[model samples]
Target: MKKLVLFVTMFIMVLPVRADEGMWFLMFIERLNHRDMQKMGLQLTAEEIYSINNHSLKDAIVQFDGGCTAEIVSKDGLVLTNHHCGYDAIAELSTPEANYLKNGFWAASRKDELKPKSLYVRFFVRMDDVSKRILSKVNDKMTEAEREKAINEEIALIEKENNEGGKYTVSVRSFFQGNEYYYFVYQDYTDVRLVGTPPESIGKFGGDTDNWEWPRHTGDFSMFRVYADKDGNPAEYSPENVPLKPKHYLPVSLNGVQENDFAMILGYPGRTNRWMPSGGIEQNVKYAYPAWVESSKLGMDKMKVHMDKNDKVRLDYASQYAGVANYWKNRQGMIDALTKHKTAATKAKAEAEFNKWANKPGNKEKYGNVIATLNNYYSKTNEKARHDNYLVGLLRTSAFAALPYSMGRGLDAYASADDAARQQILPQLQAAIDEYYGNLYEPLEKDVLAAQLKLYATKSTGYKIAPYVAKIGAEYNNDFKAFVDKAFETSIFTTKERLGEFILHPSLEVLKADPLYLLSNDLIAQYRAKSDEQAELDAEFSRAFRLLVQGMREANPDAKYYPDANSTLRLTYGKVRSLPKDKRNDAKVNYYTTMKGEVAKYKPNDEEFDLPKKLLEMYEKKDFGRYADKDGYMPVNFLTDNDITGGNSGSPVLNGKGELIGIAFDGNIEAMAGDVIFDKDLQRTINVDIRYVLWIIDKFSGAKHIVDEMTIVK
Candidate 1:
């Protein structure tokens, strides 16, 4: 019940997410992939990740901060997405007595459908190339730090002054390391509501058992409806939040998946970093994430002990509990995969080849041990950085933390250091905090910020915090400072306190003189600057990747050197596969699940299994119709490891023929390293095949009318 309420509260608050494509741009480098573009295979001269300004497909791409992606599968506001993507909604609309996790939610009628008070989805209306304008001030001579800032400021200014209006999702992204920028205009709908979900047995069936493994039988799909005001304007939730009348929507596919059938996932993939040195890779294999899993497991166990004793703490911490459980399970899987398997060894071999070539020429001195240096950095930083959060969060308050969050980068707006093109973004950046701040948590969020800084002090600087701590007392917003004690006389305390004090109360003269702070200027400047820097680093990394790719080409010219994901609408083709961890653990992998499994996992022969008795009879019949598998069985969905992360949720998995295959949800635990590398051999995408979803609509809920609208391919 608490999970339901918490999800409801978060449902209303929306979030933002990025990708790329062009001709002169495509032809610019006359290369398959360029740093100017993010998709080039390894060992190529391509610069960095960039959007294709002239591609139709690029413009058609959209992102939602709602933890999922959807495509217009119909003329109405009906959206096609993954089941796990809609988990929170399903939970919110569920009742403890009904426990949607055990059964599932199926709106008997449009009016009866469960409505999530604040559910929403973003539609991509258009994308604008604001690059030339963004980089007008930059040059080859500037320092890396300086260049990064200039590029950022420029992009922010562009987004601020001119926007696509509030009806849609909007964001600006920098690509190719200060080489380019683009603004995405998205149509946002507030009328999104729950449409369907498989019982947890099917949707998330297998629970922790099959996550991140192959030969998996996890049904991972869900459905929702989008509503709009009668006037076709974006509005808050209301009886007025009518069903959305959409321009486009994806259809539910009933076609079956076969071995080696071409498949591609189209959605907002979270992230990928294929440029880290072998050293960093080794850290992940050794202590970094492994230790993290252990620590998280310990904390979660402790939390559970406390939770079992007290219900309020459980309710307050349920979200945290769920989160920690999820992370612990997933991270453990990843750690096991890295250590037990040869994925890291594969990367090490590739780096060694690059080292050989680098040594043959003067380049060897420049790039030879780059991998080692990176690994060294990883080894040195991981332990301290991973554990620093506890210190930071436990000691500081949000207001105190904001000071460092702002200026931690440098002097001057990073983007302002460069060009007029970059300057164009200043106004846009200036308005960002005001635009997005309302969507963020300010106090509980402070805990995370404090934790980050606390860790940084102890880990990097070896500086201890003053025992004299401060917090935002309930009475005065965040003005309460317990730091008014003598213990802060220590050097480290004095240094940190001085910085904090200045930030909280900058010279009134400086504060007033600054045009940025009058508004949410600080946040605006920070994002803009960081965004640009991110682009620059990615672009540089692309170059390094090319060097690595070259070695691969030399080693196996026939093998495909897949490019890093750049949030662009790209396709990855793979088949449903599995991992045989051990004899006893060899698991069942499938496309969908059943309530029976959920009952077995939890209530077996118990009162909970009777949810079906209360449900409509039509749902009791296993008539899965055309959406059923070839085995004459109903399926909910299946998961794959096609190298995806956060943003990939709700992404449509398509076949090689460009047909929808499944909805991408997550990467199996063995695939978390996907953030920095794509393990072609093991990275899988969690997908809910459309056929299983159709079964829920046609057979389970007698909602054939909903499925009728889709252009089901097979």
Candidate 2:
């Protein structure tokens, strides 16, 4: 423990902090960043940002639906997050007769708010380092598996210790490639309900064509309210619950932004690999991401064919379609940006320099083979990486491909249960079957699965392919439609009714002989299959990676570093910034965009670029309310240099006063390689200005009551 503290102190003393390059830990704000942040125009003290004993800015932020960030905006628990973040919930609550996703909906009063089947928001309570305690349980002499087992045992105790007898949710997360550990405490409220949203035409204005691009105009915000019992403690959904009065809420700032003004973002950033080696980068850019892009596109194309022709089917698959399209574009962008910037070569050069230091006297025994092990592992797994990504596409997009694993496991358990146990599990299995069939549109699912199977079987030739799929593909002349069609026609798992009949007389032999189940089982087995040699290599690779990160820190004691993001609460600060002048951006400067540019992209009846009639009329009339800038234009979106990534969506983009100025939504296309490396000059966080969010809610949607709930700062 003493040694660990000394090493941490040495690391801090040598860090030459870069203002715009790190996702900082809130707990270390005072010791590591407060002074630097103040120099960059922060007005509040570090204690005001994160305080365990008092209500602070950290109290306002939440992990929305366990994926994206959100913030409390009102004393009544009005929560704000990105439209796409709330997309699944909104779609779930919508129907053809009352399509809230298409026409938008605002709760006229508290009783009018709509609740989805499953939704929750988690507030971060605090975090503390548990590294020394965890690491003390393992040593260098232990194998990786032994080390992992020991760590897991300790982690379970740590979580139990902090959970306060089930009142709080606790997670022990590893950082710096498992060199360090921290436990986060959070409280979750399950009775969250949708408050309001704009029409799809406005909420998703630019859609796919404009995603991850600058000079954008998308009102990408959604509102929900958290409810709790009268005592303000977490509880399940019930009509007796009321709006939660939160510990803190951010005041919406209408002061707007200009270039160089101070801006910061706080959120749970998902993941990044800034310390990844050159070989790993090469594998992703050259092999894995390309397969992911191609397979995702194939699935999207097949689904869209049916979605375009039927409204019910479109509604059923809306959320799934959006998720696939977003990643498809993102992965392709990553490939382009990483290749264009030669990120792999850059990492390789750095590795060469580190290798020299690694082989030196005292370091030779501990770190000499680290680089070789990593390189050899990546080289050997390159083809498998590509193969796995293609299969990942199938599992993500095709329900049937994953069903045999997800549902079959449940059935296997049920079949093995005794009579008394079966009575308890029968109802739960029925509900699961019902839910699965409820969301599925058979024609769309069939088409997508067939197309993806064909694509995967043909493109995954570099490694061992799924035997069942391969055999069926060859029998069908590499076309899987007829085979998939026949399987769907005969498989009991294809429909709720057939599955219900099977539940009455469960049989393991029937499940094993099922065509669809056989195909799905083979695909899953192939993906998980690993030779003994390969398994050993993987374990060595993990150990070597951890050592490489630790060795680099020791070698370059003067360099600055932050742990890579792993879905933990982080803060990043910078300035309202712009990119190099481009003909594409219609803004006067590239720092911010206006309503005029959004209207310019509008098409009368197009899906992606369509605009509502009321929005058009308001834009033409120049009926800009107080939400407009002093120059008489409605600010739509703005740019900032705050380092962010995927899970940062819906994060509060706050001004120096800790007031909400905008909501972080996307990153620029030029910096899509940001997960691997940070580019201070080109990387920008795209935010929908807070004023635009208010205007849509109060003026366009007539939800003035919602605005009244917030403390608006002008």
Candidate 3:
């Protein structure tokens, strides 16, 4: 009975489709609680969000990769998103001394706020179901690669035909790997400006320690205003730039969430693991997260030791430390929660149960290695993820906006680079660096890469980049004496000088230089060159992944297959629920955390639990403004069964009425398996309600001009 219950629960956690006729009857029942998602929010008509045949969002949400989801909030060209999302823009315009990320940023007055050099948000001008357009070019007789090539050729011809001399980002999205396709034309404007953001202590709040876990109170958002050319066309920033009047905007809500209300998050969620095979789930439990969790823990321990014994290295990798440390602590809870739960063993049993019902004679070959194949893919995915993090996060993820910084880095390395040009890019890079790195790039690179490499080593046997990384890692980890000695050749430092002198300057031009800093840049440049090759590799990976998907389909033709996520609009509905994490209910508390629980758990000096003084004051005063939910004390944590990934951050979480209820942020601990498999019980998304955002803006930043643009609802 115990094993049966566990199996049932685990199967429900990962199932994506809600259907009664599926091979696994239990997967369908698990989705019953989340039926609200099938219909989306009650407030929204189906036509308002997705084009029924198109599987895309209606022209309301404009997305930018600048860590934000923007909406044309007012007809007067005003845009609204989380405040932290706009921090990079503000930082870009700030100076080293200006330190925008530390102080929180505000436009003060419109003329005073700095404009990002090349910031922009994209709205979908049109999206066509180009599936037929390309598929027709190939037939069943063609090989998989041949099919893709034919599709690519057709797509290019169609794009050239349909574009009619207009500019937009054209992308072809594939479903079920190569099963289906679609194309979109995006109107990308290059001019965007920083409008406002709360202080880091307010916006970041709990910071790294609290990331990904609930009872969460971080505002974790940013704000920016988009602009248009004089001709009402999207253009670069200019003195004459005017605010872009948007065609549509999401309305704010006064009626906030209470217990068990249905909610849905809508945005390009970055990634999720709703489709891992049972074996993949087992491997993650047995291998992936545990390995990563341990590495992160050890890396952070080393970081702490460095911080305690050496100030300069600590300061340098502050962001890196925060990031790795945050994930380390955060993931451990998830790993613990996942391992304690019966998800893996139960999933394997469920697969076996499904096999009993669906299996025919000689079926093993059809479903052969289904689990093992998924596990293999899971092991290799991190290599691509690490390579991407190195580029997008540290190097050029924010390229359009961070171009100046990237260019400046190039210029700095080559000293003869023009100052006038460098001057143009430097101010932007300087502030962005200050805001992002806090001038801590050198040490941060060492820390971030060190932790990442450790994980890479565990996941892939012959990881393509291992040879390159091993060479660097060995030298870096050898010891303080050897690492420092070999860090730079013809160096100037002696055993006598301070760490800062060695890092901040070459001791007398050659006294001390570090290989890590120079190598970090080299890796960045090296990877940028390899990125295209990676894309080709990814295309191959996708081919292999799709073959597995096809194998799964052939094994269970009736089993529904969802398309790979392409940062396009998608709607995944499930019930608001909690998972049972303990093996046998030792505590009797089905695990989930909330605001009251969060407040009670708060520990003053603990880095993760340290609340901002201002927030604490608000709580003390019972200053429940319109922002407070019926439960009181800003409903800081809420959950939903929205299938989301990274791009989903800042997504507008809506209730049955389509009213903005929460801003999607992190996934619950049970869901960390989400990067591999979303357990229905554990797969809830953590969101900060919209009311808190309004309250924070109205109360914290006091930005009335920005507030007035919204169509507030009660």
Cα RMSDs, all models: 13.2, 3.6, 8.2
Q: Candidate 1, residues 1-714: lDDT per residue as tens digits?
A: 964444333211111001111112222333432332223112222221123332222222235435556665665566666655666566556554666645776666778777764577766555567867766777656665576688778766666655644444567775432245677665666667776776765566555555555444455677777777887667777775677655434444567665444454556654454544555556665645654565455455545665566434434444455555666676666666656665566556656555555566766654565455444445555544443433322222222233323442221343234555435644554344333342233233333333333333333333222222211222223232221121123211124344344433434444333322221233233223333544554445544443444433443354323334455433343455544343322224443343334333443333222234432243356545566667665544454434466666777765534456676766666666556555555565656667756766666656788777677876
Candidate 2: segments with Cα more than 4 A from true spot: 1-17, 416-420
- Residue-level lDDT of model 3, residues 526-549, one tens digit each, is 555555555555554555455555
Top-lDDT candidate index: 2
Write the residue-wise lDDT of candidate 2 on 462-577 in tens digits. 99888888899879998799999999988878989888877888888888788998988898898789889888998999999999989978876666568888889999999999
Model 3, stretches more than 4 Å misplaced? 1-41, 51-57, 66-68, 90-99, 136-148, 164-166, 278-484, 490-548, 551-561, 574-607, 611-615, 629-634
C-alpha positional error of residue 560 in candidate 2 after TM-score superposition, expressed in Å: 3.4
TM-score of each: 0.63, 0.97, 0.71
Report the backbone clash tally of model 2.
Answer: 0
Sliding window of 10 residues with minimal summed lDDT for model 3: 20-29
Angstrom error of the Cα, residue 637, model 1: value is 4.0
